[model samples]
Target: MRESASWLAPGRVNLIGEHTDYNDGFVLPLAIEFGCRATVSPGPEGMLRFTSAQEPDPVEVPVADLAPGAVPGWAAYPAGVLWALGVDLPGLTVAVDSDVPLGAGLSSSAALTCSVGGAANDLLELGLSPRELVAATRKAENDFVGAPTGGMDQLASMLGEAGSVLFCDMRTLDVRPVPFGLDAEGLALLVVDSRAPHRHADGEYAARRRSCEQAASTLGLRALRDVVDLDEALAKLAAEPDGEVLVKRARHIVTENARVTDVVALLDAGKVREIGPALTASHASMRDDFEITVPEVDVLVEALLAAGAYGARMTGGGFGGCVIALLDQNAVDDAARAAVAAATAHGFATPRTFTTSPAAGAHSVGAHHAG
Candidate 1:
């Protein structure tokens, strides 16, 4: 192997909290073993170069010319990170590679963005805090990549610790590290990719975002975070014609925020068994209240649960993607087999199944230091 210093940024699995981060609510997410690794060396000149394990060509772009929509496909994500970062400093070069599957709801783009941002900040000696870096990554995704995603994935990728799940308050950027270490005999965390891709460009996600903003605007709140109680807020919304939609949106945020807190407590007490039921409740609310889970994800979760999985729910933005399940280690094979069988029987490609372990956050490898 060649001598290289690299930064590894893990893709994330949001256990329950979904669509809450952008609302300035809460999220429970963990760094997974599968992620993007960028081996960064300081360029003698201002050039940004990248090659992915999944890409056929090495992409090289000038740091000075970094801008939104400047590249296409996987290249656009890293480019957006650079463009966002370049707003604050002089630019450089980079190389990228990863095992994180793209658009499977494992946050591949966010991982790549975090890896590039972390590498650039380290190698260039930029003194940005993790929170600041997260903001930058969010800006990259929202403005450059145009995803309009929440801050969960980028923040989780930037702040994750090995053997831990992160309890993050998106509004305050305060994080509580919850130990998720499972001994060989303990339960397991399994991720099942539905193989049904997610399309952020589709107006559905953007529409949801707009609805959130409209709710905030109607309530005279800067963001949904200002609403201390969803019931109270819904009562107030009763005067409006769109009260039902706003109520549902508020319901998802409030209930999801509460779930994150509950899950944190469960993990803190080593009550690993309790997480499954919470996952189930969350998926129910997401399906019935939030209406984000598609039939494919519903089938996968149902199949996993039916096979005696501890608990399973659709993960990510939910129109299509993956589901995170908590299962007894012994039952993993059965759960995965059931999920794959269900997807195949439904005429979907057999879902990809794998186990997840907590991984380290972004940091410098060869010649760089943490920014």
Candidate 2:
């Protein structure tokens, strides 16, 4: 007996406001054209099997056996989704195919989790709302997969609208839509894959989260998102003997949150050109204060800007990944070539580049009736 269904989820690119999610800050991200698709079918109640076009071996496990580190590599992603969803079945099988390049900082993991979770919601008839789906997928990544990422990726993949950016509040999980007509406005969003990989479950990401938590506790505030007075809060934190790095990290969140709002407003007003400085400022803050951008990322930004991009910044979880650039549609190719040349000149990967437009949110593409 075969009861088959398929679902799809898109990868996301954060235009601004990086590293602020765990601190309960705002982020502006959009689903791109690349995505992951999962095909699922019913099997026994407690058994599960997984396969990916990207992976060589199929991962077989029982629902009850899913746990932190119980699965490894890319398979852990969908495994974690199943664990977090509490999916206990007699048997089930899934096959995944993706255009979302792995380790590109483009939220490929979230795409995988969302596609699987969304399909499960329909296949199992769970009836979860989009917001509930976001939480569930995020939990899968955070707890089951052992990634300490925030909810932005899941939310963007689930709730993203074509031609719009998602304005998400991490604290409330509230969402507001901002129009993104950059393409119609003769602009293009370039995603440069610098090809540097960083693990969110590792010490660097967790250490940064701890820093923000410490800053929030010390300032008597709920999260960095709650800080009202930036200068005053910085002065207060800078006064402590052991608070210099904390002060820097806190400042990035405090200011980065505000930058999200500003960028959204500009985008709403059809003033996309003016948003350039904010993007550059964000890169500077992340590079200087937050200390997340690497030389490769900085080079990406510099190269994009040098090629006449209106703005550019690193777009994912710091240590290393991808960078996003805003430029005239006509300039996209030159900018991309410049970035590759720049990366190559510095003894780095040649760099992969592409232009992306906002894409629709996760949805079902096909299903086969239960047998």
Candidate 3:
């Protein structure tokens, strides 16, 4: 390891629990092996410099006060991490590279942000715990990048393990790792990229969050996590029909929360084979009820399922992006091939496919700064 070195902040796949985080709900996410790798080194000028494998040039920023929507393009993610890090630790230099596709419904920005934060923590010996890293990265995204994303992605990227799914409570920040080593059983988690991207700053994503807040406030609860199901919530909403926005928001949160709990219980019981149905249900709910899934994503999921996937559905914030499916290992290649052919036949751009496995959380892979 050099005086400074690189760290891997991997992207996450949410098994279930969509659009429920802002409502203080539970989420099941597993960090995938693919993500941003930040190679960092100390700078004599007390400046932060960053470059990405996907970018044309390195973007540089000062180690002082950072602003929201400050730097443009991919640079803002790592730059924002550095700015957020500086609030706790003063200065450093960083360079980032990533395989995680940006805005492809994978938490690429969160990975880069956490990778930079992890590398900076090692370089500065900030002694921040993994939990602290999660908090810092979330702060960076919210305050610096101006994306009001929940902590699920950042937490999964920071606390992931190679063979486990993370069951996290967004309200309490408590995480329990659930083993998902189904590869030996001839089952694999496949991600099919729909090639459609979602923008977090767009009005649609923000509107959903605002709706959740409105619902929580109206219900006299801190968040929707306090509730159990949508039917009970609907009855309350019917008492005040004017609260239609709150009703819709509460519906998504409550139903999604139940889905998360059920999926986790199934995983715990070694019922990996039973998860496909839940996955399909989640996608449909996010699409028809939540109104997040776009046409491209819906088509992709349908194509995958039609091709004999155990279950398939769109993952991420939804306007357009990736779909994940559970498939028999032997059927993976066929499933992927059929998805590509179907996309082409439907006049949609071909999608890429990759096998996903749980990955470890953020850790120091390089030598610490000399004391």
Q: In terms of lDDT, which candidate is strongest?
A: 2
After superposition, candidate 1 runs with Cα above 4 Å error = 1-5, 42-46, 87-91, 199-201, 368-371
The TM-score values for the models, in the order shown, are: 0.90, 0.96, 0.93
Cα lDDT computed for each candidate against the true fold: 0.80, 0.88, 0.80
Q: How well does model 2 score by local distance difference test?
A: 0.88
Clash totals in order = 3, 9, 4
Please give the range of 10 consecutive residues that has the lowest summed lDDT in model 3.
84-93
What residue pairs clash in candidate 2, if any at all? 43-91, 44-90, 44-91, 45-89, 45-90, 45-91, 46-89, 46-90, 47-90
**Highest-scoring model, TM-score:** 2
Better of 2 and 3 by lDDT: 2
| Candidate 1 residue-wise lDDT at 368 | 38
Q: Clashing pairs in model 1?
A: 5-366, 47-93, 48-93
Lowest lDDT block of 10, candidate 1: 85-94
Off by over 4 Å in 2: 199-201
Task: List model 3 lDDT by residue over 237-350, tens digit each.
Answer: 756755766676678778788888898998888888888888898888887667888777788788779878778888887787889999999889988998888778878877
Ranking by TM-score: 2, 3, 1
How many residue-pair clashes does candidate 3 contain?
4
Provide the lowest-lDDT 10-residue window in model 2: 196-205
Clashes of 2: 9
